[model samples]
Target: MRGMTDLGPLSLSPVMKPADPPGEPLPGIIKTKVFKEEDYINMPWKNGLGGTKQIAIHPHTADFETEEFIWRLALSEVRDSCSFSVFPGYDIALLLLPEDERDGSASVKNTVHLRRGSLTSPVALHHNDQATAVPLRPLTPYTYSGEWPTSCKIRTGPMRHLTFIANRELTRVTATLETICLHGLHDDGECSDSDEAVHKAPGEVNGTKKDATGNGNGTALPLGDECKNPMNGNVNKLLIGNYSIVYVVSGAVRVTIEGTLEPHTVLAGQTLVCERDDDSSPTDLAMTPLRKDGRAFEKESEHQDATVLIIQVNILRPERRRHSSLSDVSSFSQARPRGRSGSIIVYDDQPLPPLAGIDGDTAASSAARAVAGPSSPTSTIPMRSWDSARHYKPPVFSSRFKNESEVPPAVVRDQLIIDEFPVGAISTVWINMVKQGLSEWLRIPVIVARGKEEGPVVGITAVVHGNELNGVPCIHRVISDIDVSTLKGTVVAVPCINVPGYLRYTREFSDGKDLNRMFPGSPTGTASQIYAYNIMEKVVGHFNYLIDLHTASFGRVNSYYVRSDMNDAASAAMAKLQQPQVILHNSGQDGALRSAAMTRNIKAITVEIGNPQQLQNQYVQWSYQGVMRILSWLNMFQLDPADLAPAAGPPSSTILCSKGYWIYTKTGGVLEVYPSVNTVVRKGDLIARIKNIFGNIVDEVYAPGSGVTIGRSSNPVAMAGDRVLHMGVIKREGEVLAREAKENY
Candidate 1:
């Protein structure tokens, strides 16, 4: 392969293959083509959005409008905030580069705020939540699903970027910008290691930025002017896939494949494409930076800077198999009753899972059976996993509550964990959750409303899942509106409990662990566990009753609903007072904050407000009213005159359900959930549909049983194992469990 200096299209040699391959290129000498600046195709973007500079495609003449290529690359220009074009079924990777030589101030203002699918969809939110931004360090490659509605806001002047899109079904692509100092002293004094590269160049170093020189993974060798000619050691090794591309981001580099006898010199703006055999182990290469004279950079020489973008691609790699896009269940053989709200619909499809039903940790296959079994069941119709659940005994709270380990609730001495029940005061304070990295602390904002008269402490927490924000305003309003002078009890509101997740605007904690599932966490465990333990010990322990406020996670929508154990008189009372459209008699999901609170003899219930990442004022008002009603019932406060009336509309059709489960997608595609929140449907009714990028419907979801929709997936983009619809079964009016629960509780 020749490295060309002239900007002209070179004629093909007789043995050269087509630039675009039909499928996987046939086994032979690797073929590649370079597009000169003059040959690059520049045109208006899709929908006349903006301008695009393009080169390199699988189908040399593939149409981006039709999304017909296996992969495509483009360079885009941006200045301020910008929205990215949505491309279905393709995985997108981007690299940020400077518009020109930059200064120190630009570094601070150049970072970009990136978001995918508006709220990171169901999978990203569940699996990889983070709030950190991608800095404008030139050459750092960041990737996301192409179909997601992605956008970025730049803090500074004009910037240019490289956008790479690869077909999810046919290939894998990854790019890393590395700073290589082939010959520089590892120590402060003299020559040391041969390869001292900042492997994670122009980007994050363990999710943090160290300096402007790009020493992400390791230290960049110090280079001085005094040292001159030096000896070359064994070169740094770079692993490659079917195609290994070396694009010189800055300075120059001397590159040579292991088998090649001669080395080639590549200049800045030039990209070297190397191809090897299919399914072969990554190719090892000798790569070294070059001096201005084109010779290898010497140890301690003035050749202090060199950066390269190494992009690897594999052909014909099949995409991962997704959960079934649709699942079917036979008719409900029996409808059993567990409580006033519990309408247990026993279907033939879902099997019994483990007896220990965890609220937040259930996987796709066992999702339906994860709901907490009733404290006492009237259901003659056996539910899934009931055989095992019948053998398990519930935790009995004594005078002093204890966890499963029997660790007594130890009153903590820390300033925030311990409370001073001051009379007639409303106070707001920030409590540290955890220390991030070296110095940053993620803190929770707590609002405490203490009444003049001593009474039970009620804890209200919101945003346990970062994106679930509807409850945030609801908590704030209740705490602010309450009259502490006349109130009989204390009210504590944790507006944003999962601070890292809230800041990141995703569903999970900073470490990507679902904080809701790590309750009563250990003092020594994973990050999420430690944080969870702290909340239980420091914040939650202060309350005698807990109202864990919530909303839908990313890519999902929910109706106002309450999940509470009807067996508990106080919890059930709180649930009914919320005025939710639906009440599911879920004792509590294990590991859920509400459930964890219950173990401490703290009456608890979970209140789901609405869709996430938004302040739906209507839902917020409803939630505020619900909390106020609960407070009034507890004799904590007198209700406002205006709140005496029910919600704005005709009283909502509040349905009571015994059990619920989320249906999952079988495959990946664009999805449309047909059922709206609170919609009632029968076994054969259409619930949702999925379509391939070409617009042909690939899958259709039918209702598994007659039920009211509790919540469902909202994002149009779908992947296997993502949510479909939350189905809540309806019980006959005046069921046997309803009469028995009131008497027993």
Candidate 2:
């Protein structure tokens, strides 16, 4: 035991342990040493390809600071640049790494940022081919590269980086390997280029881009000799043919075959390759680097860009290689005539490795068909292909409202209980409440307002359509101004109807069903229908008089009017409450709550005010003024109606028609209406014309009989048989004519 020092107190010096061991370095070589700002050569390579700078590093150079190659331009700001290697006798693996974090290797046709240390497979190619090293932004769009094939038969897309194997000794270059650290939950495990990458070609134009100038054919070249140069006893042996395999590597990649390179996504640690050989079945091979490159590379760039490593390996028979070099093996080459169609087969000369079968190495070659899925015969069946589909579960609907008391009451004069309907009636009633960031568990307050004193129940509703928000605030203003303290009756103000649609700020509900048309709906119907039913049976049923509020749909403007069933006592009573510019005495069709209310001897009138999708001060004011007038009439509020006539609502001509004739267009086209609503037309009158976009007449819509035009199409566009106009015949006109003839007698 150590003894303590003398003095009041003594502190021990803290001993430091060595920093946690540096992360285990990745498994492969970093060919291009993590570049320095000085490593980028300012000198340009001027060829027929134009002036381009280059940075060439010999194989197996060991000076690496990071796994990623970081190069910066000397310009004021960095411009996007591409790096490539011209391997005359062998294929080199190259990845397009962008410093921009927004770039993604997975994205098609757009720049996509990727996580650090992501990599793609080795891109293979023929000898002496100048392939693209990378892609850039607005300046060097993927489309600007002349190497990218353009097809009128297909939609154009961005060009991608190319990795190719040269024509010589079938060199096998694993992608510039990178190690990715797993974070969050996106842990699929580390991946690297599989043997499949070397044999696969890029994607074909998606039928949208057809190469009329390029030859669509396949040719087979024989390997008379094999390259004996070996870094290790284990060397990649690729059979001659069009092979489909996922190049397990990083970043973006492309495979060019028969002159067209198809784009593919190469993810880090995982293989992404396709094997579809023009000859025989696609072959899958393992990508193993027998040679050691001492250069140290960053797993990711300092800027956090991704990297990719690719390999192309060719195998030759032992007998063929004895007489000549690997390039001289032309005896096995066979050139098919021009326009050769379909696939060709190249037999494998060597035995498969024992581990290859179990490791699913052959699966990569089979995976080629997986790209097109079951539709392509070349695809191998996926492991899950035979599995049964899991059962689907319906969405569970929960109610936000707990109970009756939790229901909020939009109280008016602090007494009348204007209750909204059940919460389950609308699927999205709580959507607006959610956007307001209200608790899903908390019930919303009912919009109805009431008077302090009890009397005849009078319900005022506005904005049956959600887009008509103007009516809601207008009714709110009207209810607030009412002095219900002196009221002789109960005034229930429902400031909003079609609440779901209102939340969406649209005229139609979430189901695209109009809440207005779904009157007296079934209890088991959809949300919109259920809402209508609940309001009619629960809310409307409580009142002796009902005023349904509404507004024109978007793109429509109309004069203020009141719709009431003629010859009905309640309808007549309610019609007197609206001081509208036009009081239309109309009969209700089936499913209308007003008609149902008429059956119950309850007064109900639907008031149309303002336009859809927008609110107007004048309309709101008019609505407020009209509501106040009605309140005054009922003695709920005391107010002097000077400008507004105190006498009933108004004296207006009653237009009657047993049947309304609807004029429909015979063909689909644009409709041009000459007469507006309220225009009197005779039978066979040209009410409208339909013409195609080219201005050629398609059809003419004519009036069926003498009548007044009451409605016309609001939308200029129309389909065949679409109703263009409606004509209301005046039976009274016939009566007047007959009466004048009788007076002559």
Candidate 3:
């Protein structure tokens, strides 16, 4: 039997290791090697329609024609319709290269017909019966399985494409290709032949002349005074897993590695390959544009920039183990030989009770059960303690509270007894769950601050939608400012509720479930549900009041506002305490934390800060102040009257609306918003305009009712039905009618 090594945790596997020392490979590491363009093997395709340039192959010894390779990358040109090679167990990905510049929009009428089982079979992949064209865009890749006798026919003239193939049973491979045109680098606005234009010396356009000082034609601007490649300052380190290849598409670049003395010049149509031990430190490489003649320059020079396509490959193995600090244990069955008597047992070299019939099962069956348990050869098993039960210490309250004997006891006195926290102290607790494979634990941090005096327990949760990061700092500030000993009651803060999404920099769980929608979650449900259940049961149910912090979704900006069920006096009062510029009378959405708390008779409101993903300091500070104000209003904390700033006159009466709608664009184009968030508008007011690529206005979006803009799209590109603005119609004070009558056309 083959013994497998276990990698401790999945959370740490994706992190790149630090750079290794020069010239030494780490132990147990798989080595990587780079393959250059000139080194690629030139051979005829299996179908012989055109030749193929084999980029790299796994197991180095595998030949394209004779031996079975685990994976391969290659390029081929198609001049005529042709059959493709059949690989019984391989998955294939194909990318169409840019159309030949010489072709230049002559209505080439290109179509690629694909058949799965045989060349004579009907099309297996097509848009419709009338359209057989494979939408092959430049640098855009299409992936398909090559397990059967698959082939494709190209109707247009000669076209070149790239292909990637990997054995479905052995390895997984992914490829991405993008081309960045450097036409903007030429200030003279002159075009040249494809190859010559790409290789032109920096600072010198084809039709332009240069003087002794190395400046281009007087009319053309010098390529920035220093001539430095903008990419030189970037960190371009690559971790060599198994094998990796970088191909220059249409530009020249200088490559510098740690151990190399001088940077190597790589030109268009060339490749720079590097092979290193997988477990070794990362290989840091700096790439910049190469000067003419590949000469080294101390200062910036006139050099054209190039676009490069990088492809990374990793060889998969069954017993792969990652470095970790956790301890690994061996189960009893794994330690004993096959057919061993189950009646015999040992613990720390001491004999224990026999395994024969403790549970009324036969010894042979018991042995089989042990082998079928949750333990695997490649799993990191945890060792059990000699003592079967755990002992927990009791928490002691602050001595200062002993003198106040007249004070009434808390309604939930036993709550603190089970909790591992001392009264009048701030501490953190981890809510842990067994991961799916029982290979690791998923831990969520919960910060708790208990007060010596009894008052209302408040809960603050942020990052419910992981990308809404602005509220994270607000919670941090609230926690830091509240002195546990002086605070009344208690404050619980969960700075990042969606741990998985926060780690991945996304807005949802790994399973694609929205965490916010899994409130009052079920224990037997999905991952998000389990997490939500634990939080609501352990933290939310104990709160007397709750503030759920959030921000706009990605690519959108929002003004500071509060959303609460204004019909409920308690919820309405909590919303008003935030002192936001806009207060929306919204009944929290079902499954939302705020809604769940409201049902529990807890006053709750959601604070909508600025943008998502990024922490805007101004908005963060604003949210922090808002939270502090709420605390002061509840009498949970006190501040000197003299220190309070003067209130900004009478607040614009809170905008009351039954609901709001996000206005979407009817057409797709480059959108230009005419108003910012919080701007008031009348019916028919122009809110945005869409322009075609040619700078012609295509359409204009106007407000359908008198309302205030609470949110608007920040991304310039828009597709049909993409939300462009979020408007809240004013329903109180007759403001809508007055504005409409005043702005009558």
Indicate which candidate wins on TM-score. Answer: 1
List the candidate 1 regions with Cα displacement exceeding 4 Å: 1-413, 417-421, 645-651, 733-745
Return whichever of 1 and 2 wins on lDDT: 1
In lDDT terms, which candidate is top? 1
Model 3: residues with Cα > 4 Å off, grouped in runs? 1-419, 433-438, 640-658, 734-745
Q: Rank the candidates by lDDT, best first.
A: 1, 3, 2
lDDT of 2 by residue, 300-369 (tens): 1211113333222222233432311211212323222221121122112113323222123355545643
Clash number for each model: 7, 78, 7
31-119 per-residue lDDT for model 3 (tens digits): 22334466666754321234567665543433344444556667776544444554555666665654433234543235232211223
lDDT of 3 at 294: 44
Candidate 3, residue 150: the lDDT equals 38
lDDT of each: 0.60, 0.39, 0.57
Global lDDT of model 1: 0.60
Reference-based lDDT, residue 76, model 2: 14
Candidate 1, 577-604: lDDT as tens digits: 8888898877654678987898899999
By lDDT, the better pick of 1 and 3 is 1
Model 3 TM-score (2 dp): 0.42
